[model samples]
Structure formats: C-alpha cells, structure tokens
Target: MRPVQRPRRSRRVLLSAAAGAAAVTVAVLAPQQAGALATAAVPVAVVDYDSHDATEYAARWVNPYGPLDGVVPQVDPSGAVTLSDVPFKPGTDFSVFDHLKYIGISTQTFTVPKVGTVTFEVDIAASTPGATPGHVVEGVYGPPGAWSLADPDARPYTATVLEGQQAGVVLNMIDFCTGQLFDWFVAGGSAFPLIERLPTSVTGNTSNPGCPGATEVGLDKAYTQIIKNIPLEPGQTHHVAISFSRSAGQSNVAYALDGQVVATVTNVGIPLDQQGNRYAWTGTYPSLGKGEKLADQINSLSIGHGLFSLLDAFPFQYGCSPPTTSPGAGACSPDSAAYSVSLSPAERSFGQGAEGVFSGFRVTTTGR
Candidate 1:
C-alpha cells in the first residue's frame, strides 16, 4: 500500500461496552511446489489475533516463527484497541508505524525476498455500531528498507530526498483496510488510483501519469482493475483478504483483494540520483538482524501516520518551500514536526499492558 498523502479528521462517539470485538485472519501459505500457484503455501511468522484477550491485544504478540518480529498494540482501560467512531487520527510519519510492532521481525533484517507473495485473509467487524470511513483502516507494508542510505545517523528510511543515486529501493504496504472507503476517504478530489502508486520522486512529474495531485488523496496511476464504491459497515463482518506480491527489483507489483485481482503495476520507474545509479532494493536493504530493529515502522499517509519514516530525527527547517497543490517538499512544515513530536515516546514495543493473545494465524513465504 502507498502511504496516504493526506489525512482528514473525523468525529468520534462511544459505541458498545468496550470489550473490543472479535476478528480473525487466515493466512494462506504458498505451495511448496516451485510451479504451484502463487497462493498455495506459506511457512512462517503467521499472526493470529482473533482469540486474543485484552492482555494479548496489549502485549505477548511476538511470533518467533512468523513473519512479524514483534507486535506493539495500543489499548486502553476500556478494553482492546477497538476502532473509535471518531476519525482514526494517525501520527505524523514514523509515529503511525512506531505505534506498531512487527510480529517476527526482531532486527531490521527482513526475511521476505523481493519476489513471491504473502496472502492472508481477515474479518473486520466494526466494534462500534454503524461503522463508517476512518473507523478502522488496515494494510500490509512491504519489507521497508530499515535504514537510510542518504543519512547514516537516521533510523529507518528518513532520506526521502532521493534525487539520484540517493540510496536503495523503497518498499512498504499502504492501507488495504476498506477498498472503496479508502478510495473515497483518501483519494477524494483527485483522479484517484483504483490501486497502485508511483515512487515519491515521480509523484509530481506530469508525464505518463499525466494526472496531477490536483485533489487530496488521489493517485496518478491506475491499474487495470479496482473495487469502487464499497462501504465498510460497522458490526458487520467483511471477509477481507489481500495478497502482496512483487517482482525482482520491484519491476512490477500485483495486489489481489477479496480473491480478486484489484491492481497490477507493470512499470514503476526507478528514481535516480545525480550519479544515475538505479535506486533499487539491493544488498543490506533487509540486513537488520533479529537483534537489530529500526526505531519505527510505517503507516498510511492519508491518515498521517507514516510521515516520520521520511522525516529527520529532529525537525529541521526545510530550506525549500513546497507546492501548495502537491504533497511536495513543503510537507515538512514546522507544524508537522510539532504534531509528530507531540506523539513522542510512541510505542516501539508493548512490553507491559493488559494482555491479549493471537487466536489467528499468519502464512508467510519468502524466496531469499
């Protein structure tokens, strides 16, 4: 999923007695046979959160054999971290993802190779009644390049200024929570992408994309297929499944939603630096070992969570201004920094809290 470019505020209301709600995820592992269908079987790091109680929701979600290296959930005294009717206000950048913990990733090391697909299914019932847009959003992120090649001191991929030869390839999933709702909520006012995104560098370029970010939340590119106008209702269980698959060096990416191929990207141009060395996922991009982990993770940009992944450790004065129409350089406003820092001490790990355990399972497969 591509990071949400814009986020909007929503109203919140108390629903039922907190206890959270029931949810389950079934991960279909890739088949072991080399020529088998891509969806056949998976072998490790599965995440099962359906049966987790309050305690499990807060902690104890670390799966050694699963794809996640850790899981950091945020809960309250009321119960599990159920979605609030109020808009899901994500933190700026890293805070969006820092609040989460990967299930099996102990270090910055990512085991998933550049190829292969990981497919999983889940049930999301709005814990509240009349669940609407911005209530509960979810998506899978590719194994993000855990370190910044542009700036050595920063953790995660903060070196967002990839002009040319700036660094390695970038990967991470964006929101796939509510297909239609996501499109409307985030891609509204824009030509909107049914499902697909361009690299940051190419976002403002008015070439093949042709369409501009004239409106908030819209994408310039659109795959051949899309699920439009579907609403996410509260208290109703929507069986949702998403598969994340990519080719070597990200030549292409294909995503299937609810068993249907929703988007396919055949040409994602490489963002080059002045040196012209292609910015591709290469050596060390997934080098963080079990003991080594980045300071934070990533979240959808539309809701304003994954901003930190591209920000400097401390807010710096962006020498250049940004375009008013585009989520360009000016996105690094001092106000943005202040807002993100406000969420300081974001949860990097859920060491202690009311506990809940995963009742669901994950199916993870890799080529490396």
Candidate 2:
C-alpha cells in the first residue's frame, strides 16, 4: 500500500476537513512555542464498517472473554459496525467487564519512535442512547515487553524498558450511563490518587451500574484521579485525538476534541519508572477504537538497554467481517436472526442499530 500522504496544511488553518461542529487546526505558533509542531496526519482506519478489508483496519484475536460470551463483532455495508450485545442490569456480576458489548480495531498495530510525537485521531459517536455515560470509549492495548523485560519476544510492545508490565489505558466518561452529557477522564502520571470508600448513592457515582463491593472501589480509582473529564458533544460526531509528546523533562498526553485541546494527562504511571522516556503503540489486534495505544515503553535511545521485545503472536484479522462469510447485507443473517455474532438475548436495546460510525481513523508518528 502506498504511504497515505496527508495534504500539506497551513499552520493556523484547519488540518482536516471540517466535520460535525469541529474545525481541527494544525500547530502554528511563534518559533519559541513551536514544540507542538505536528506532522501531517496519517489515515489509518475508516470507521464506517462497510468496506472491512479495504478500510485498512483489522480485528485482534485474544482470550479471556467478558462476562457475556465473547462474540465476534459485525460489519454492515453501510459502513456501520457492532459489538457483542450486552444487557444492562447494573451488576449481576461485580466485575467491570461482565455482560459487556463493544468492539476494537487491531492490525497494523502502530508504534512511535522512542522520541517525538504520535497521535491516534478518530471521529466517534454512539449509536444507542447515543453518547450516554458509561458508554465511554476506551482502549490502547498492551505495553512493550508486556510479559517480561529484556526479552526479544516480538509478540507485544513494551511499556517501559525496565519492568515491561502491560495493560490497556482506559478513559471513564464522567457520570456513568448518562455520560453527564459529556465528560471524560484522561490521566497524567504526575499524581496517584485512589478511590476511597465510595458512597452508595446511585447518582454521580458508578454505583448506579450495580457495581458494589470490591468492584465499586475499583471503579472509583479507575474513573477518578487519573484525569479530568473532557466535555464533548456526545451525540454529534466529533474528531478526537490521543497524543503523546515529551518536552523539557515532561512526558504528557493531550486529549483533543474537535481541534481543541480538551485535557492533558502527564506522568501517568510510576511502576515503569519512565524517567524521561515514555513510549506508546496503537492497535495490535483484538481491541477496539482506532489508534488507541496498543503498546508503549520508555527507555533511553542513547544507551544499549534492550528493555523490551515484541511479536505478532496472535492470528491476524483484517477488520471484522459479516459473521456468515456471506456476500452482502442480505446474505448475512439479520442482527436479530439468531444467537450468532454482534447480538444477544441478554441485551437491552435503546434503539441504536448495529454499531458505531467512526468517520475516520489514523495513527501518525512524528520526530522519528
């Protein structure tokens, strides 16, 4: 495939075509403030599910199913996609992922050089209840050296050259289920705060989801202290970008909505001991959201520290296809057809059909 060239854009001008209500602009400023200069954005995945293979995005193969039986996602020719059907009953189970419904975009897992900037940008919108809370968007898969440190295993990316522990980075939309209209949590490593004993109130808290006992505390820490909630136009399609950049001894992540910086999380995790090095990868496989970091690691480039290894161990998938391997819409069974993929008997529908419409996606690395 040819390298997708981003049209040269003038600084101070919108970098991408105006969409929804946003006008995203490229970085432009006085020479002293030029640290934020961005390279041309790369075109990664087409959110519309219609052209599965042609879209340049793929699915991942992983184990450990959510509470609901793990069913493969589904795609429609109209460029729509759907996750496994999950019914909302608060908690019959206390875990965060029990009885869930969602999908991820893997394949062409993206990585950035040890230095510079990489951003995964996409336009997202919920189908049902539309941008309601708890219907949050999250995922950036593993870290470099996921299993061990200094192992040349190429299966996953390393989080840091030191420990090599791995987990996904998730954002909790403020006000679960309702989305509080639109507020999100994006953490920066500068601080570490824990969710103390939470109140049982069903409002402004995660308890409404029926999460109690240990799960409640877990939810609190996950959703709180990491970052502030970014206010967004929940229902309207919005351009969102997750960017990692290091400057002047600081490693920070900026979350942008519709061309404007909404939140910035810095000094994210301490275990990795990133020092001045923080690395990130995007979408290896079996995950959702385009450009969500698939893996990341931190280490010095000037040294000979072989802190991590990576490998494409899992089987590859080029986007989610129609469950039936049939031709088109008619060929594939209706979402209500049977207990196949993308739908479930344990589902409660709020009238959003099928899946989300990700208008566009891309993972771009600048600064080598």
Candidate 3:
C-alpha cells in the first residue's frame, strides 16, 4: 500500500465561522509553551477479544467441538477468546471439531479519532493444566508463530502493522515461553528500513543475556521490547501490549474503536548466529489481477521456523454461492456474490480519521 500523504500545516490565521453568531459564548484560554505540545496525544481504543462474554461482540463461527473445544470455552464481543481448561499435559493434542471451517471467531471495528499510533492489549493465560509437570500446549493461531506452552525450545511469535498501505516492522518476540509479561512500542507502518525480527525473554524482559532460552526472530528495522508474558496458574491473568506509532518516513494512520495492535517486531541489525543469515525466503509469486493469477499478500509477521504460506479458499465475506464450472469459477470470480465489503469512501471510513489516515480495516464474521 502507498504511504499516506500528510496535509501541509499553514500558519495563516482565519476568522472563526461561529464568531459572529449571537448564541455563541466565549471562554478564556491559557497560553502554552511552543514545543511542549508539538506531538498530539491521539486517542486510542482498546477492544478486548475474549471468548467468555458472548454479548460483547458477534461470532462468525461457533463450534463446541474443534481444536479450541473445552479450552477456549467462551468468546466475547470484542473478539477475545478465553481458555480455562487446566492440567494441560505436554504432547497432548485436543481438537474443537467443526470449528475449523471458520477463520475468525469474533470481530469489532473502530474509527480513529486522530492520526497517531494504536496499541493492543491481549490477555492470555495458561490454564492450571499447563502448570502441571510434563503438561504442554501451544497456541495454534493468534498473531503469528507456534509457541509451546511446555517446550522451552519453540521460537517466539512476530507481529506487524500495515501502515499507510504498506506493511511495517515485523517484530518477533524471541523464545517467549518463560514469563508472564507484556511488550511495547512497535513502530507503525510508516517507518522504513523495515524491521524483520526482535529477541525477547520468557521473563518479559527485552534485555539480552545471551542464553539458549533467549527468543530470536527477524524484524524489518524498528525497535521493540517484550512487555509481558503472564503464565496460566490457578486464577492467574497474563496481559500483553502491542503498541504502534508513526515512523520517520510517513504520516500516521488512524484507527477505529475495534482495531488493535496485536504484535510487534524489534530490529537487531546483525545476524544472530554464524550458521546462516537471520532471515530467508523460499520463492516469489507473480502478482495477478482478478482473472489473471492469484497472488497472496506477504505475511511479514510470523512465528516459528518455517516459510510463510497462504491458504486458498473461498472468501468468507462473500459467503458461498452456487458452484461454477468455468475456469476460476465459483465465488472466486470477480462478479461473484462473495465480496460483501466495499472499499468506497463511505464504507471505508469505518476505521479512519478526519485527517485522511488509511490504516486499512478488516471484516469480521458474526455468528448469528
């Protein structure tokens, strides 16, 4: 996506439109320092995505029998899912059957009051099951990366923001299974010299001690630090913050009440080890139009040790329609009924600010 163009600030004074109105009232104002308030404090909205509260947000899909079955027993209106199952044994796999058909469980959209950075606070807790000896579990989805609950060897997870129209720093929280802490300050999409990864500790500390448990990942070119990583104990709560801000190269993007920053990447210019480079790519796919070829967007933020991959499936927003027999048939066609969300000026403003910030909005499914 292209960077957002910032409007030029002018110093010329103009008369107020309501100045001459008879009903208008005036109040005294105090003078402030020049550079003191140079940076505006933008208002940010925090939406919690938990599964326990059903009325808060709407669910796109609900299944009591899937990979998340007894684990994530509840979902809230803010799109938060909570897992309370305990005694999570290592190497044990459970499934919430029939729920795999849907991608997102709950979703919310918010509007940006001003142009600034946006942050997300995600609360994750390991159940009493996870605290047991030999019990282990890993997050299958959410942000990016495969994090093990028991194994201390899994790689950290990565988070990134699509600033303006382009993706920004991809912050990776390296080896993060040890602590119950939160990370902070991931640069928004505007910063360049992109960040690929960042290293973090299980103790919720960003300081590097040069140990085997230290988590390492790739980032484009931004600074970030692990803030929190609360483990699941009996009645324990873990909170994490993924903050986003404007970098040097571009203007800031506005956010809606429902949007949030789930992850971030920190930049470490040098390679982590001598065996090979810190980052690598498998192959490139050609960009194609609707009828040409299908090219997937790059998932700059990812966790674990594997090449990024995209899944080919029916666009959920467009819903399933009658099957087609022609090449590139089915709902994949441009004229299919599967594309429900419009990118027009009116509909696109759901998560934008008056300053013309374009932080891109996501459409979530609601389970009736």
Candidate 4:
C-alpha cells in the first residue's frame, strides 16, 4: 500500500478545526520543559477526526468485535469518537480469558526523520457518569515491531512491548479506581517512576478497583513526587502530548499533559519497522494493497481503545493477580510478566467497559 500524505497545516489551524464546543484545558504534570524538540508549529500531518471521517484520514478501524457488540467506536457528527461498550469480560475463572473484544483506529504509518523530533497529541474527555473513571485513556507513538495487517490474528499496534523487550514507547492517563488521573509511561520493558500511588481517597479504600492491601506494585517510590494528579471528571477535556527526539548519541521521548512536561525517557533507540527500516514517526497505518510487503505499522493509535496484552496484563501488574511481589512469584503474576499487566476485579469492572471522547489528534515533526 502506498503512503497517504495530507497537506501540511499550522498548529493554529489544526487546533481551531478540532476545538469543537468545549474549551481545551492544559495542565502541567511535571516541572521540566518539553524543550526545543517539539517547538515547531507546522505538522507533518493533522488528522481532524472532528471535521472529517476518521477513515478518510488513515487506513482502517481494526478490532476483533463488531458494531453489534458495541466494541466498535462511533465517530459522531461533532467529529469526536465515542467508545460506549464493554469490549472484554474475564469471568471468575482467572486462569483464562472468557471474552476479549477491542477496537482502535490508525493512520497510514509513516517513517520518522533520522534527526528530527516527532510529537503525537490528542484531546480526551470522560463521558460515562460512573464508568469513565477508573479506566485509562491512551496516546501512543513509536516503532511497531512484528505487527502485520495481513495476519488475521494481528493484535492492535498499540499493544505494549513486554519489559526486557524493545519495540517502541507508550504514554497513557491512568484514571484508576480513585476517579483521578495519573501519568504512565513505558519504553520497551522499563516503566517510569517505578510506582505511582493514587490519591488517599483511592489508596485509602481497600476495595478500590486496582488497589489491594499491598502498597508496592512494581517500583520502590511514589510517582506523585514527580507527577501531579488531575481529576478525571465527566465532560472535562484535557490535551495529552508525547514527543520523540533523536540526535547524535542521544534519543529520548518526553510526555506532556495539557501542555506541560510530565516525564521523559532517555537513552532510547531509533524506532524501526518490522522490516528493519528505521523510522522516527508513526501516526496511522495506510491502506495496504494486495502483495504489498512493506512493514504494516498499523495500530489502533488515532484513539487507543484496544484489548490484547494491555488488558490481559493490567490486572497482574497492578492489581496483583495473586498479590505477589517477588519476581515470577505466582503463576501469571505481575512480577512474572516483563511488562506490568495486572487488572483487579474492580479494575476489570472499569476495564470491562468505558465511554470517552477524543476531540483531536495531530503529529508534528522538526529536524535538528
């Protein structure tokens, strides 16, 4: 399949098109600046899901379930995509997954410049009254390794690479049981800040979704010391941005909430496609024509609402499936998994289903 390229647009024009009705709020989650990496105002591509059919912007909406199951998200006339169904359900039998349904949209995958920075940003708002909180909304950008569109069982491109594994980078807002938002980042197998404790109202309650009696999940310290808590309320819109920068002997990715820098991962390598091709930026997947073999970098990226490894691992990693801490302590435990993948009953309740809006999405690039 050939690459689909959209005419370049300035940040001002792109933002205006996706402004919609609600005003976008920018909050600072960390003290460090995003630096000059993403300072460019012109974008390589601007996908206004609010103004155009999301399909027209990229390749496909790939998922295991169909619209009848409500796993397929709807892009309303207002130009926002709404996820309103329970995609996956794991019964009392914790040993196996009973039902697994997921959905996500992607743009035609594009390679990144060798010496430039690539930024992917989106605006999200909780929509469900009681279901939105305790759920996470994700924004992802990175190299897609070993993912193929031709494979009938191909997982979502956003499926995170396990720890001790190298693929790409990921950033998401964890609006866990407390109904508050927290920043989460993982590159390959390494996750930032080690551990992040939600607000007292969340941790204080033993019955909270993913919070059990234990204080340690993966790390040794609390993430609050470096990141701030943002309320995850219905109808409130927040902007999330992640930038990947590469230069001589240095490669790092920075995450920003609203408009402030929150966390940055350093010493990262250049993101490569499955074909061993080096690309700096990837937004969506382009439609693949017959017989095309270029690495399909497709993912449910434009809005990451998918369940494969992400949902499967969320419980054991954070929920402490068997509530064990020692590495490989229990069968299918967080410690045993390379990437954090724990989902408690309460966490599963939230993950079982959710509703939210993605008002806008864009990707910008700047060369050093």
Candidate 5:
C-alpha cells in the first residue's frame, strides 16, 4: 500500500529462469439498461513477459525502519516469480531500531481513462511457509503527496515519509499447504482488504463527538478495512480482480477474489493535474492524461503490482543500542526493554518462495 524510502542491498541467492510469453483475449459486455438492447463487449488486453522492461522487473529491498537482511526475486521455468531466501550473513545484515522485509516489483503500468470501467486481473498464491506469510498487492495509484494539500511535494503527511496516494486490494495468503499440515491450514484463510489512501489534510484534524479538536499527528494514514477475509493454505493460488467504473450519474469500484465479489466503493476519488485533467498512469510521476477533460469525463484509473513490507511504527526510543531511533521516534521510555534485541520478537518470520504465482496480469477498459 505504501512505498519504502531507503533501499539497502542485502546478500541474496540469484536464481534465474527464462521468461515465457502468453496471451488470452477476453471480451466483457457492459451492463445493459432496463429497456435498452444489448451492449457491445469490451475487448481485454492480456499481458506477457515482454510487456515489462527487464531492468524494471526484479526483486529488491525496501527498509523503512532500519538496516536488515532481505531476499531477491527468482523466476522458475514456468515463469513463476518468487522470493529466494538471502540468509543473514555477518556484515550483510544491518542493525537498526526496527526492520521490515523485502519486495518484488513490476515496473509496467496500465493507463486509466477519465471515464468508463477498467478491470485488472491476476492469479496469486501463498508460496511461503512460516507463522506469518507474505502477501501481494494489486493497486491503482495517484500523484505523489496528492493526499497532503498543504505540501503536495511532501510525501503524503510528511516530507520524511516516502509513501504516496493509492487505493487497491491486498491478499494475505498464510495457509499451511503440506498434506500433513492440512489441518493447520484454514479452508479459506486469506484476508482480502480494500485499502485506500487517507486524506492527510483532514484525518487527524477532524472534530469528533468525544474529542472536539483532535489535531494529533498520525503516521501511515492508510485507510484499510477488511471487506472479505478468506484463509488459504501455503502454496495455494487464487484469482483476483479490481474494477473501477465511472460514468454519467455513476461512480463506484469493486474488488473480487477467487471468483467472488469481496468489496465495492462508491464515489472514489483519484489524482488530477493542475488543469483538472486526470493524471495518466505511467512509470514516471507527474504524468497527465490527454484524453477526456476531468470536468467532461467521469473519473480516472491506474494499476500496479508488487510485494511490499507491512511496516510498523514505534512512538518511543528503544533498541539494542541505547537511544536507537528513527524518524518520528517520539521519546525514550524509562524502561527501554521494548526495543532491546533480546525482547523484540523475530521480525522476519516467513520463508522464501514466490509470495504468489503471479500470472495473467491484464487489463480491460471501456475506453471512456
């Protein structure tokens, strides 16, 4: 849901495989009016390995808290991408106040018109094993700092944080897929969430019934709510899709996982340029759309895929190194055992493998 600020290299095994190309054509019909006849089918564009630039697609590290070990992406003969364990080597790991995991990102982007419906589809699996499992994200992003009106150039709510405005769906696959471990795995144990970017300008500043003026600053103001929660076993794969639709007198978004509609949002807002045109979805930032004008069109859409660490924040100073701290590390507590190396729980609990068997990544739009 959020992007990492600092990038540090960690020792990892480099496993390479050949890329495979495939394409499928799918046409979906638009919803018909009560009295109208039939609507035309919108053609779907399927993507393949060639669609992504080699230099841009790879597994990498994203440490938001502090220095820590990480893993890299591995492609198999079947074209499945997974994270290969980069065991902790003496000097390779960094000691920090806190630590997060790694991520594998796809650099390609899909366009989002100002109006009409657009759907993004992909298949994912829980290819990791451990108490905690890795998850994959499929999302639509807006301009950087779009949520912070006070400082559009600043990252969201603060200049120190490196996150932007985005709304998407997440799948946390934590099943134990082994036959002997079948009983430990829940039938449908994955958590499907419809996540959104918070409006930093009004979030902590809003007035409430109990607290009239709550201007407390908040970090990682991402609006995440579980629309559907279905568990899955390790190595289990599932289909996922997110659709955005906007037209005359209509505005909504829908999220589907494993062939079922999990969540829907109405009147969704996206990024726009100074001239009021929807920002075009591209690999680069500050890109604007040249299609329909914002006022003249219904809405906008964008797409992305990757595995990002679920970051955690601490409000006090505590770590193996006394006075250890980071951005927003408020104050030092009298008893600093909360962050001592011996007291802190293991941060990296999942094993290495494809976070999911990501495939069939494609988009279909009405071309509004």
Candidate 6:
C-alpha cells in the first residue's frame, strides 16, 4: 500500500488568497525522497511598529542561532558622525554625502549550514518624495575584497528599488519634517547567483508637499525584498546580510510603486570554502560640505542561521533630498532624520560569533 501525504497549511492559505484575488496561480508537485532533505530554510523576522524607534524609525532585530553582528556609522574627519548628502529643501528633507562611497546600515556575521538561497525583506518610506534623482537604497555582500560599489562582482549586484523622479512618494506615521519607509537589498556570493531589488511606491495616498514643482506623493509606503543564492561549505557557510537606504529613504523613486519588483539577478555558483566567517558594513560618507550630508535612516536588520539570529535597530543621522538636474538646486540639508548601526570585530568571524543590538524606529516629518 502507498503512504498518505499531508498538505502544508501555509501553502493552502497562499493558494486560497491567490484564488480569491483572481490571480493566476501555478502549483508544482515535489518528488518524494527516501529521507528528509537536509536543506536549510531561511528564517524570517517582521517589525511592525513596536520593534522600531518611535523617534527615528530604526531598530535592530536579532536571530539567536543565526550569524549576524551589529551596524555602525562611517566616521568623519571632524570627529562627528558622517552622513550622505544630496540636494533638498532646508527643513523639508535630507541628502546623500558621496556617490561612490557605501553609506547605510549593515548586517554582519552570518553562517550558512548548507548551499541555498538567502532572502531579505523590510518596509521603508521617506520624508520628502519626488525631489531628487541620485538617491538610492542599495545592498552589499561577500568579503570586503570581493565587493565593490563601482563594479560589484557579477555575484554581488545592486538594485534600484525607487527611481528619483519629481512626483509621487509616500511617508511614515510621524508628521515630522520627514518620514520613514522600508527598503531592502540582496546579493549572491560566488556560490549563489540570484539577485533582486524591490521598492515600494505611493499607493492609496494622494498628498504632495515639499517641492511645489513636483506632482507625485512626497513619500512611499512599501517594503524592499531581496533574494540571493549562496553556495555553502560541506558542513556550513558563514555569511552576512546588510541593508542601506540612503538619502532619507527618498532615492530611486521612479521604481517606487506599491509591491513592485525593481531588479533581479540570478545564476550564482558554489563557494570553494564556506566554513569561515562573514562580515558587513553600513554607514554614511562624512567628507562633504555642511549642506551635502544625508541622514542615514536605518530601521531594523536581521541575520539568521538555522532559525537562530540577532536583530539591531537604532536612529542615526546621515542626510536626504531628491536628485537635481540643476547644478546646485537640490543640495542636502541637515535635518537630523538619519541613524547608524555599529558592529564589533570589524572583520568576518571564523568560529563562534557575538552581536550587539540597538532598538528604536521612528521618523519625523515636516512640511504639509
């Protein structure tokens, strides 16, 4: 006689939801194996309102058994924390500091027990929408030497969740001069070659502030999702994940639509040695003039390993604003809506690892 199989509850719910929405749905059947597959399932962490900083819209959520460290700020020369600087209204928005530098929050310390794909997601918003062009929410992965902002390896790539335009953006709950949003970035190491970028757009809202010349909402209310394939070692692979939404979460607005997929990358290979350590970095560039610093606003970051991991959420200052076609029209102003995440053991860890946690997620909005 043949054995009976049980259906997955979550799968059933997903199917029902798809059917109710009148969306095309496809189902695939998996072949039964003699023993349970030793594949590792990526864990998930969700942060609604409670997990973030009410003031800055930032937080750090952790997974116990996962390999993830804390985030930090990129130091400046004046002994003050640095931020990315772009062009914008004085009290209305923030800015990005430099173009090529890596400025945002990071996820350090991750371990892969098997070879598979790693995915990440987060909800993000901005204060002033549709004001600039050079803004972006990017993700970086792989060893320090293996990654690059200018020319990232084919494995670790970037996606533009939102494209900078002159209209249609959304904001967060707080009514400060600025608001907050969710953004995510993903990269596949040498092992996995799948990459993607997801950004949110202005949906169900019709409000325009900040730039009178702009048309779309001044902010976005949505999430950024990332998926990457990674090759693990024979036993385990130590890896890291990081998220950085620069320019007060206002860059790349063209791609900012509700539940839109911005970029996708695939075809990653296997790693030669996976049983090592992993590290990540996130922060802002600190060398620009006073009016060109962006407030780095990071909400929450997570690292998972076999269902155990760590989270850190905090508020730091970088800068913001929309991209400008004019030479000096939309420069970044200091509005204090940015945050940072700092980690220890600057490099990847090979053995047992530890992480720090910072909790706080909030954003202040100005203007009408």
Quick one: best TM-score, which candidate? 5
Pick by TM-score: 5 or 6, better one: 5
- Which RMSD does model 5 reach against the true structure? 17.1
- Assess candidate 2 and give its lDDT: 0.27
Residues forming the 10-long window of minimal summed lDDT in candidate 5: 14-23
CA lDDT scores, all candidates in order: 0.23, 0.27, 0.21, 0.33, 0.30, 0.20
Every model's Cα RMSD, please? 18.1, 19.7, 21.5, 17.9, 17.1, 23.3
Number of clashing pairs per prediction, in order:
61, 39, 69, 22, 12, 122
lDDT of 1 by residue, 210-246 (tens): 3333221121221112223333332233323333443
The digit string of per-residue lDDT tens for model 5 on 1-368 reads 01111221121110000000000101112233211212443333434431232233442212222223344444555444443332222221122222223422233334444334455555555433222323321211112111112333332211111111111112221100100000001112344443333222222224434324333322222222223334544334556666655444444555665555555544332322222433222211221221111222222233334333222222112211232232111222233323211111222222221233354455555443
**Between prediction 4 and prediction 6, which has the larger lDDT?**
4
Candidate achieving higher TM-score, 3 or 4: 4
lDDT of 4: 0.33
* Model 4: lDDT of residue 210: 39
TM-score of each: 0.32, 0.39, 0.28, 0.43, 0.45, 0.23
Per-residue CA lDDT of model 2 for 202-303, tens digit only, reads 233344433232122121122212223333332344444555454334344556655766554454322111222332321221211111111133221110
Ranking by lDDT: 4, 5, 2, 1, 3, 6
Summarize candidate 3's per-residue lDDT along 20-79 as a digit string, tens digits. 110011011111211222344322233333333554423533332234313333444444
The lowest-lDDT stretch of 10 consecutive residues in candidate 1 is: 14-23
RMSD of 4: 17.9
- Return the lDDT, model 4, position 49: 32
